[model samples]
Target chain A: MLYREAGQFKTSYAADQAIFPLAQDRIGMAIILAVAFIAIPAVANEYWLQTIMIPFLILSLAALGLNVLTGYAGQLSLGTGGFMAVGAFAAYKFATAFPEMNIIVVFLISGLISAAVGIVFGVPSLRIKGFYLAVATLAAQFFLLWLLVKYPWFYNYDPSGVISAPPIDIFGFAIDTAVSKYMLTLIIVSVLALATKNLVRSHIGRGWMAIRDMDIAAEIIGFRPLTTKLSAFAVSSFLVGVAGAMYAFLYLGSVEAAAFDITTSFNILFMVIVGGLGSVLGSFIGAAFILTLPIFLDNFPRMLGFEISVETVTHLQFMIFGALIIFFLIVEPHGLARLWTITKEKLRAWPFPY
Target chain B: MAFFLEVLTGGLLTGVLYSLVALGFVLIFKASGVFNFAQGAMVLFAALFFVGFIDLGVPVVLSAILTIAVMILLAYLIERLVLSHLVNQEAISLFMATIGISYFLDGFGQTIWGSDIRRLDIGLPQDAFVFGASVLGDDIFVNELDVVAAVVAGALVAVLAVFFSKTKIGRALRAVADDHQAAMSVGIPLRSIWMIVWAVAGIVGLVAGIMWGAKLGVQFSLSLVALKALPVLILGGFTSVPGAIVGGLMIGAGEKLAEVYLGPVIGGAIEDWFAYMLAMIFLLFRPQGLFGEKIIERI
Candidate 1:
């Protein structure tokens, strides 16, 4: 019933151009914000906030970052987790070295660093496409991970070969509590998601779509392939970097090289493919759906009162996960985002054959 | 000099093992364009299943039969369930599907066996033959198992060569690989050909798995081993049978030799990136791969 946009038509061009053009969509989004900011902190327990939701959100952001490049821009990247590692390590170093810089600033700077790396890697995409390009991106993943492992300076020469974030304070408010950390992440993710939504609707985003549609035609039409692709790399990496910082600071707290391995890259890639390739909101839904399903399934065997080993659970999870991906690709190859859109459409026309 | 010889010999042994695994990937890619990233995982699973069956008191001959049966079943499953559905999808979609399969197989293998690395003693002799002043034990040797592995890999490659040239099923598979629609119109059962190819690929994986599991133990290590095959595919064309064998050996031996000789000079364990680095060089010059068919660029 609330899905109806009838009789609430936009009067101005600006109103029509707004992202949530429908009045109900705006209100619905506001309600979601209220629940997330107000109700979630009140209801969610510490472990839920710290372990599951926060990590999911940060990963959602990273997946979103990757989806823009791979899904929207038609570049396949298997190096997101590596870029995230760079962000995490960069944030760790920034915080540790300065000890005076604000944590928020540290986070922003990590994204900038990742953006630079993204541009460097994006150089290859101007030359390669499809499988060859993916292999090149895979090279980046291995190379970056190797660097993080070997270059002692990245870890500040810590013999542990891992980096840990010290407790951070945002605006003199200590973000040590699970609630506070969750709030911080929620705020930043909201702002970035909003920004990404706006960015994708803008002229530059159009340029990206143009390139995705046909790079040669885009070039003939005067879209600079180099600049457009590089900027995509930059923007995409920056967001991914911020996500990594959060992953290190909020979720993992301390991580070894294993956290950002090739599998992690694949996880982010799967999230995008499974979530709904080019859609921003689909990234979050995909992350939530994919990330939560296994845990839910892992618990299902036990919750239903079956005594299953964790290893078995892990195995079953993989099989189910694999099947789900294939199933999704088969049923709605566009991803969970497309599925959501269809659902919303159905909801809008509920009880009406039209 | 002795150490060099020993390293070289060891490298060749490992190289042969890698070629065996890479051969499966090459074969699948040849028959169908799908790169079986799950080859190593298939190896691990097959090996695990073989040993697990034997541990259950299945006779040696029966265990081997059951394992091959399992692989053949797996091949049919992929064809019926995954590939046929993805026949019209893009390369990236197919690649993504394979990634999903890889994860599923790895997880499935671990769950069944409970993640413990099972010791596989297939009643094969564990004695070593010595070369020169240094002794190379049979367990690690170019001994009975390794010799068997080498001969088996070579024979399969040869058999595939003959099968492709002489057999109807082989021709059907080739026809489908060349153009699915064309093959279908001519009455070649596309689905059956895919099943045959995947089944054959699965058997190839089983052979490789037995050797690798014997060496590494049947654990999650299969996925990592599979990663090595990517570089092999890069060196040999994706569709080349002999190319896979040759490429796998070059990588296997090349990585080991590099690690042994060049490790101390430039940190260590160059094996991780050696194949990739080599693959990248090949990609730059011969993007279709060493034995890959020629490409015509079009919009």
Candidate 2:
């Protein structure tokens, strides 16, 4: 009854084409945003803000980036971690070189750097398709990591090859606290995520979806394959790069090139796939699921009063997480977004067998 | 000159092991069209099981046989639990599923066999074979393990070639690879063929695991070697057995030469990404791989 949109009426094309066309969806989204912006910030402790919310947001952004290409554009990339490394390293360089510049500017420049790298790697998509293309991306993943590690210049010649984000200030407001960092991440993520929604709704997004569905058909229909594919790569990598900067600057603070390894790439791809490929909200859901699962797993045994070693917990987490990935794929390859929609449908038809 | 020979020989031998792993990938991909990302995990699992069995006091030969049996059981389990349920899905979906399988196998292998890097001394010598100094005024050398690995890889390729051409099941697998619907139409049980293919791939992974594990120690990196096989697969065609062989040798040799000659200039450690970079550049000119057929897309 609560989810029913039967009485909802749209008088104009703009109204009908609105992101949340249904009144119920609009209300639901408003409530979620309210809680996220107000309730959580007011109540969530430092640990939750720094450890959980910040990571969830950053990873969701990364997942959104991957979703753009792999989910929306049908380009299966394994170079996400490498691109992220580019972003992180670029940001590090920017922040150190121009210490007086705005942190926001640093993030944007880094993202652009990553976008350039992404396009270079994406050039292979013109020549290669499917599995062959996927393998080509692996070169990006490895080569970038090697570049970051081999060159000490990226890390500001730190003897340990590890770099830390310098203190960032916006208009004399030092964003060093967990709450401030969380707020910064939230603002960046929301603005970019909104832009993503708009982008996906535009003809460009349709072009990507067309390519995803059938590149040959998309090409026949007057879309340039190189431009469409590279644009997807550029936009996706830009978001991922920003997320990488946030991950290093806001979340981890101190990090090394090793932080963004092949595992990180696989993890982001999993988030995109498990979150739902083409759904915007699915990115957040998938990120939250993958990121939080490990923490929950680590704490569950102890909370139940059983003393378990950290090693055992980690091992169990991998096994369970792996099984869960398989389970989700088999049960609903469309991911949690599809499940959410299904539940909404059920809610609308409540108290009926159908 | 002798030093050049040593580096070349080393690369060739290392390339053989890479080919063995790539062979596992080619077999499954050829038969089922699933890009089994779990191939690396299978290598790790097989090595772990073999070593775990031996750790429990089983003889090496018996442990090897039992490990093979376990891999066969794994093949059956995967086909039943994962593959059968996922039939007729998109190639990307199938690929993602295999990645799921990879994660599971990685965790399961380590959980059962312990995650510590373990040494397997199957009495293989570790010393290098040296050519006498009188011939070239310097000793030419080859690692014994590399020599053994190369010989084993050669034999495995020969045996697989014979099996694919001569065996009935192999012919059926080839049929399935050619066209799934046509094979099914002819009453060839697709499930059985998949199982056989996976089992054979599992065995190939096992051999790769043993040789690599012996060289690097049975550790997580053994799984990463599987990633190295991807460039080899690209260089050699993913479906061509001979392609994997030559691709592996070229990659192994190319990376080594680059490392020895280009490493100092680049500050070293080019081995990690050299093969992938080569494959990426090569793909621009030849996307179907050196041997893979050029696919013509139809709307």
Candidate 3:
């Protein structure tokens, strides 16, 4: 009854076509915004902020990036870790080389670098499709990973091969605290996620979906395969790159190249697949579900009083995780996005069997 | 020159082992367009499952038989559970689903078998006989196992070729691979065919796991070894078994040579990328692969 939309008729095109056409969604979003921005910060402890919240936010950002390309445009990438590494290394270089520049600017610049690299690598997608495209991206995965590992200059010739974040600040605010980092990430992720949602609704986004749904049909409909596909590659990499910057800056605080291995790529890809391909909110939900599960599984034995080892719990988590993915695919191959649609549809058809 | 010969032999041996895993991938891809990222993971699972069964005191032959049975069941389960729903989905979703399946399998293998690295010695003759500095050792001083693996793979491919050519079920599978709807219309059991293909792929993975286990022991690396096959597909094409075998040998030799001759020049780590680099170069130049049919996109 509360979800009823019968009385929400619009009087103008601007109002009719506006995002969140439903009045309930607007309020629901505002409440969610209030909690994420206002209420949660006041109550949540530091540990929650540091581990779960920060990592999920950063990964969701990365998934959103992948979603734009893989989900919207229908190109497959197996080298997200490679691109993320580029962003991380570029951001590291920028932060250290020009220490005076704002860290946010460094993030944007890193994304630009990744976009450039992404386009270079993405050029092959014009000719390749499906599994072939995935293989081509692996070239980027190995080559970029090798560059990060081999070249000493990228890591400032650090003997340890790990880079550390120099205390990030914004105009003298001293944003080192987990709370501040969480807030910063939340703000950036929200804005970008919103922009992405909007972008998907726009012409380019439609073009991407057109190409994704059917390339030949899209071509006949006057879409330029080259520019559309390449731009998807570029924009998608940019979003993923910025997420990489955040991941480097906020999550690990300091890490090695192994942090962005193929497994990491697969992990994010899994999140996108599970959360809902092509849905922005699904990215956040998927990231949260995948990332937070291990912790829950790890704590389960303790709760049961069996006193299981973390390693054993981890192993069980892996097995169950596999079963879960198959379960989700079997149950809902469209990911969580389908769940959302189902929910809305149910709401629409409430109290009637017709 | 002796070193070159040694490298060639070693590389060819490695290629033979890799061909086993690629065999699983190519078989599934040919039958079903879904690129089984889980092939490597499946190899790891097979290796572990075999070792686990043997270590638990099952007779070697019995363990192998039991493992084959389990694989058949696993194949049917995956087809019924995961793949039936994904029959006509986009490639990306299916690919990611397989990745999920890989993660699940990795976790599943680790969980059931425990995470410790278990040695999988299925009693394949390990004693080596040396002919001067050149060694023709054991079931594996590179020569014996190489011949065995190559021959086994060849036999398997020949059997499959004949099966697809001679058998009604095989013909049905080929029809489905050619066009799913038409085959379905002609009353082919697409579900059962998928299950059979997956089961065969699983069995191929079992053979591969054994060979690789003899060399490296059962470890997580078996899954990563699936990396070699991506290039094989790029070299031979996804749809061709002979292409897969030939491509596997080429990459195995190429990666080994790169590791030996090109490693130091590129700071000593070419194996990870040599195959992929080769694939990318081929993709740029040929895109269709040597044995692969030309991919013509309907404009």
Candidate 4:
């Protein structure tokens, strides 16, 4: 079988502990990366790159960030959009304030700033849990958005209150085209996804899993709740913030504070939930599904020769989305990621039932 | 001072309306341990159905009856379709499911009724109730509709309070709230209790929908009122009905006062985040909320 690992053997601890220990997994990842970095860019149109691919990559990164906290650390946060706004605004400020700086560094600094803000909001999680903590995160979501809009300084006092991404001139080479933007997002997302995969597997990730499974037991086992929880928030926010920066600069090119509203937060949460709460690969799958669903719905009716109104389609989209969430939860509570895992497991045992 | 009183009174009245929404949330959470995030959507759906029926030239009374029946049916469907399957799941899972329900209801309601704003008029007086005109040489006005809302909310609370204490089914609901297994052992059917509680919550949603719809006009934004009720829930305790009323009043008055007194100092529109911030601060001291049962976690 193409997916079999029968001949593959780990010779050492490093090989055993590898993220993609199986030869098949490594090959699959290589194919995926190659497709993302090469094949898609070569064949895809501007609209696919700009409208679909860019947002998909950026939101996948955000969903990954959220997965670190809510999925791994057991802290349910609704402040993703807030943290993302912080990143976007911070990136805007850093980019404009230091025009000569590299864009990647600008995004990193913005993420750091978002992490700090995330920590401040995450403080309440030390005391509150569950839906109560979720509500507390909404304070961050609303207040941060409010701050961005209320103070024009965040937008550089633009009368329109929308911030436009400055041109990306890296070493005097302009990276402005959709392919270049998609490439930038793709590279960053790939690297971060790799980092997140490792981070979640490390001892810190074990600490997060411990806290998530049972905070009291985790605490009793010498995991510091404060540091573990706050670190998760910090790391999660950093990733989300970076995504927000990319979203503003690469995907949308111009953004307002309203762009990162509660709805945005919920969508990211949905991505995490529907994808697989605790899986790194699930983040991408979930993001892709959530992003592509509306487009699929819009075109499906046309393909079927049904002339549905856009308004009705939009309503149907919501109904289907909701129904799907419930359906997914009931049928496979672990999400699409779990389904993928099951498929792979079945493939490993295919043609022989023991 | 007169203006301050007007704002305070107005906020308290508005708070009563918030309590009405929060009450539905309390009913579901207490009975079934499911935080029904769809409560707001239920309100919107009920109001939309009522208004939609009326727009079709159904008499107001008939429309109200039909909407009530629809809400009860909705409760049954939600219980059978959603809650029953999700029984014994983690609280967060149930919460997420309710959010899904919220989305479905929002879309379903809008799809059927059309998403445009519809005016809901059930002959409630909309004139301003004037007071202290001669005493202060200036009239202090309270909207008559708000007064009706407060009275209606108060009466509903009283009825619920008595129903919970005196009725046989209500005691079963309380038992189920306490322990699902124990309640089932006591010959109380968990599913029926859940269905009944959801039905009751649905009726509460109808009342909230009617009042809020009449005031704000039946629209999609009516669903956002659920967000406002969240701070009230945080302040009052998720499980306590009386706590909802008190919490709603506090949040209603606190946000209004802050918006009025502090709006000039800071730019305007402080109402949006003020209640949440207040609730957040309150949560630091009492994570269980003012009236919520103490949370005791076991390792």
Candidate 5:
């Protein structure tokens, strides 16, 4: 009965269209935000903030970006890593060149640069479709990585080819500690996630869904394929780029172009797939699941009192990861988000099946 | 001119080996409509199995036969476990499933066979055969192993061509590829066709594994050749056998030429992305590729 929405009537169009129409949902979200913003920061140690929460939020942002393009627009791209590299490099250049600029502005500009590159790569999607388009995106991945690596100027002629993030000073306040960095990432991710939720609920998102379902029919219905698809790319790349900037500046502190390789792209894609396509909450859930899996695998054997070799554990990690992907796809192809929805539905109908 | 000829010959030889890998991809795609991203992993697995058996004191011939049996078994397991369950799923899901398979094979293969790079010696000559040394007072050489690879690839292609044309099972495979419902209605067993195709693809992977393993030691990175084969598929068309061979040759020669002639100006190492760029540009003009059938969409 706690989950029932029986008396929540929509008195107006605004109320009907509210993101959380139910009182229970609003309360649920408030509790979650309260936990993330207050409780965790107060109780959790530096290790949890640094190792788990920070990276999880950054990668969740990346997965959300991919979800917008591949999940929402039905455009499968393998070029996410390249776009992320663009963001990281651009942020580095901006932060160093103009030290006075606000750090958040620097990330936005980096995201904009990534959006431009994404539009350029996304041009082929108009003509090519399906797996063919996916392969075409690989051109963007390989070419962008090569371009960054080949030009020493991109890294400011660093000898090691790895670029370090400049210090984060927002209005003369230092964001050096793990908690500060975690807070910074949380605010940005939460804001962006809220904005993305609104964007997808709007007409543009409807256009993307229409195109994804059937491009020909979508075209016949007067949805301009060019703008709809390209806009999706721009928005998706923007989110991903900001995430990449955070990944470099806050999480890793220093990174090379090689850090955003194809494997990274695949990991984010896995997050999108496992989390749930086209769902904002799914992105976060997926990122957490994928990120924690290896850690769980590593520690589980030790907890059982079996001393497994590191190499064997790493191999087992790969095998189990692969097997789980298949298992998830077969059992629940829609992903963990669908399972969550099912649970909520059951809760609403608890103790009475008929 | 002599140096150019040497580079061209070397690239062409490498292209032939690439075609060997791409051929396996074509076999599965044509028969089962699943883009087997795991083909490269399958290659590495076969090579690892072959070498692992030899390390166990089995003779070379016996090891080869054992690897073939294992590949066939792999084909059956993949069909029964993965493909059968995903009968009418979207193409993207199937592709992702293959990626999962690729990861499993990579970890499982390395786990069983050990991750150390082992040299594969099936007695192929490793000498450079020089050509026209006296005519121009300059030497142009080619790897003898590469020549053997070309000959072996040619023989395999010829056998496949005849088998496809003459065998009853081959016709069933084509039928299944053409229209699954029609083929099944006509009593052609869809499951067996998929298994046979996968097994045949596995055998092709074995041939490619042996050739590549002998050239470069059998190791984890051997699976990365799948990335190279992708551009070949894009150029030649995913569904065409002849397209795979022709596309492989063009990419091989094109990348080598760009690397040797254009590398210095661009700080070298352009080979990594050259084939993909070429294919991407080519796709702009012909999305269906030169040999692929035209795609017609219906609303």
Candidate 6:
């Protein structure tokens, strides 16, 4: 009865087109936001805030970026790690060059740089489609990492070639503590996530979805494939880049180019696929599922009163992760988000048969 | 001049091995339109199993036979469990599934055989054969293993070519690759065709593993050869056997030449990304690849 939207009525076009038209959805979203913004930070421990939630938010943002291109636009990329590396190094360079600038500006600038690089790599998508295009993206993956590693200029000629994020200060508040970092990440991700939700509902998102569903048909309907595909790449990489920057500045603190390798690309792709391809919420769900899985594997054995060796745990983790990917794909190829929507639909129709 | 010849010869031999790995990819892709990302993992698993069997004191011939049997069984299991459910799924889904298979194989292979690198001795001669000593006033060295590999690859290709052209099962495979629905309507079994194709791919992976394992030791990095072979696959064309051969040679030769000639300007590690860069550049101009059939899109 509480979840029902029986009396909700659209009084105007604006109301009908509102992102969350239902009173129940708006209330649910507000509760979720309040919990994330207030309750979690207040009660959660340092380890939980730093390791679990921060990475989840940052990776969710990256997966969101990827979801735009792969899920919404129907373009496949294995170069996410490379694009993320661009973001991290670009942010690092921007911060060091202009130490007096605000950290948020630095993140945005880095995201723009990532967008430019993404467009260059994305040019091949027009000519190639599917697995072939996917392989082309691997060029970006290898070449970008190689460039960052080889050129010391990107890392300011650091002897070890590893760049550490300078302390982020926004408006005289240093983002050094776990709570501060978590809060910053939370704010950035929420804003981006909200913006993405809006953007995907707009014309640009429709164009991407059009291309994804059928490029030829979309083109016949007057949508330019080139611009649509390029914009998807640019926007997707921009978000991925911001996440990469946050991953370095907020999460890892210090990272080498090798950290963003092919495996990292695959990990992000897994989050996108397992989360749910086209859905915005799927990104967060996927990231949460992937990030928490290891923690679950680690603690579950301990909780069950059996001590496991690290190596055995590692082996089992891979096997289980692999099996889960296949199982999820077979069971629900649309991803975890589909299941969530299905449940929501069932709940909405509870106590009455359609 | 002698140095150039040595590098060229060495690259050509390396290309032969890359082609062997790419052959597995082509076979699977041709038959099922799946990219088969797990080809690398299969190479590693096969090598590890062979080495494990050897360590268990099995004779070389028996170990080889047993590994082939295991690979055939793997093909069956993959078809029944993974590919069957995914018959009409999109290419991307199949690609992701293969990646899943890769992960499972990586973990399972290491768990069963231990993660340590083991020396694989197939009694192949490792001595360098000196050439052009009298003609060019300098010696050019060629590893005997490379020469043996080239000969073996040539023989294998010849056998495959004949088998594909002359045999009933091979004809069935080509028919399946042509059109699954048409072939099914004409009384061909799609499942068995997939099994046969996967089995052939498995045997190719075995040969690649043995050669690479003997050269580089049977270890985790052996799987990386699969990734390295990807550029070769793109350069050659996914469906063409001749494409794999020529593409592999070009990449191997081009990478080696670039490392030696162009490495100085870039600080000397161009070998890692050279093939991919070449593939990327080539793809922009001819997306279909050197030998891949032109891609015709439909509404």
> Across residues A36-86, which tens digit of lDDT does each residue of candidate 4 receive?
889999999999998899999999999999999999998998889999999
- Evaluated with DockQ, which candidate comes out highest? 4
If scored against the real structure, what TM-score would every candidate get? 0.92, 0.97, 0.94, 0.98, 0.98, 0.98
Model 6 residue A349 lDDT score: 85
User: What DockQ would you assign to candidate 3?
Assistant: 0.62
Indicate the residue-level lDDT of A101 in model 2.
96
Candidate 3 per-residue C-alpha lDDT over A133-231 given as tens digits, one digit per residue, 9 for 90 to 100: 888898888889988999898989999777787789999888898899999999999998989899999999999999999898898999999989999
* Candidates ranked, most accurate by DockQ first: 4, 2, 5, 6, 3, 1
Residue-wise lDDT of candidate 3 within B171-290, one digit each (tens)? 888898898889889898889999999998999999888888877788887888888778888888888888888888888898888899988887878788889888887777777777
Tens-digit lDDT string for candidate 6 (B99-210) = 9988888888888888888999979878899866644777899989988888888888898888888999888888988998999999999999999889889888999999
Q: Model 4, stretches more than 4 Å misplaced? A: B132-139
Which regions of candidate 6 fall more than 4 Å away from where they truly are?
A: A1-5, B132-135
Off by over 4 Å in 3: A349-354, B123-144
Pairs that collide in candidate 3 are A318-B107, A319-B107, A319-B108, A322-B104, B128-B137, B128-B138, B129-B137
Candidate No. with top lDDT: 4
Docking class of 2: medium
Off by over 4 Å in 2: A348-354, B131-137
- lDDT per residue as tens, model 4, B10-54: 999999999999999999999988989999999999999999999
Candidate with better lDDT, 3 vs 6: 6
Clashing pairs in model 2, backbone N/Cα/C closer than 3 A = none
lDDT of 3: 0.85
**Candidate 1 regions with alpha-carbon error over 4 angstroms:** A1-11, A348-350, B1-9, B123-148
The 10-residue segment of model 3 chain A with minimum total lDDT is A345-354
DockQ of each: 0.47, 0.76, 0.62, 0.78, 0.75, 0.71
**Candidate 4, RMSD to the unseen true structure:** 1.3
